[model samples]
Each structure stands twice: as C-alpha cells, then as structure tokens.
Target: HNRAGKGLGVQLFHSIEALKTYVEGPTFEEPVDGITLIQEYILSPESYITRCEFVGGNFVYAVKVDTSEGFELCPADVCQIGDLF
Candidate 1:
C-alpha cells in the first residue's frame, strides 16, 4: 500500500487503541508510522459519502464515495489505484 514511499491519508477508526495498533503494527511491509488523531466517530446515515465542488454560484462537480467499499480517499487518480479512493 506504499505508493512512491508515502502513506495513504486519513482513516477513521472506532477506538483510539485500534488506531494506535494500526499505526504501531505492521500493516505495511515497512515500519508503520503515524500521528494519533482523537476525533469523534460519527455514523453516517448513508453508506456513500457525497463530495461537492462549486465555482462561485455554479456547482462544478459531485461524486458519491461508497464507504462499504473501504476508506482510501485520495483525490488524485495516480494515488487512487487498487483502493479506489
């Protein structure tokens, strides 16, 4: 999951310990590393998330991200392979 030797971005976890384990554990082939983020986990009403972009008064773009698939939310196409971010 190491793309050009950089990690994929933010992930939401149920607990701090789970997040800590993931950060400390060998989820990667190399040593896993990260900052501990403590945030409230909000349960979404839908399985998919909607992202919208606007240009002044005009709505430019929107997309639905299915959380049922998984969390790999990179905006770049190059970085979005395999995980379908």
Candidate 2:
C-alpha cells in the first residue's frame, strides 16, 4: 500500500467472501487507477516444503514444517545424510 500513491481510504477484508462482497456490490466502484491484491497460502513448518531463493550474496534455503536433510546434517554429518529420502 505504501508503494502505491493512492488515497488513504482503503478497506481491508479478512476473507475471500468479504472481498467478493465488496467488489460485487453496487455501492462499490472499481478504482480507475486499479488495485492489486495478493493472497498467500499459510502452511505449517512440518510440511516438508522447501523455500529456496537467492538472498544477499548467496543462495538461502528454508524448510516449512519439517527439518530438511541439509539441516539434519552439518559439518562432518553432511555426508551421512547424502542418501536420505
């Protein structure tokens, strides 16, 4: 919101249904400038999901829900988990 130079009056919705109501109602007029809404799924840390990205000057990785193989092995243990499922 800060990145876009729009009016200060902005409404927030807690659910998709609420957002749909706002957009479909006759009282609402679509902003001429347009609006962008971003929705992200929330997941637990033990889901075995990996979020790998380039950050800083190197590649950074993170796991959601479960500890990854790279996490279980570090330093000397790195080779032990090489064949881990």
Q: What TM-score does structure 1 among the candidates reach?
A: 0.43
Among all candidates shown, the one with the greatest TM-score: 1
Clashes of 2: 5
Alpha-carbon TM-score of each model against the true structure:
0.43, 0.33
- Per-residue lDDT, model 1, residue 72, is 59
lDDT of 2 by residue, 1-85 (tens): 2233221334546798987887789867655567654445454556354545566869886534242432231222343444564
RMSD of each: 6.5, 15.2
Per-residue lDDT of candidate 1, residues 1-85 (tens digit): 4343223454677787887788688762342443333457578878876777777989998876666655555445666567453
Regions more than 4 Å wrong, model 1: 1-12, 28-40, 54-59, 73-85
Worst lDDT 10-window in candidate 2: 67-76
Clashing pairs in 1: none
**Once all C-alphas are superposed, what RMSD does model 2 give against the true structure?**
15.2
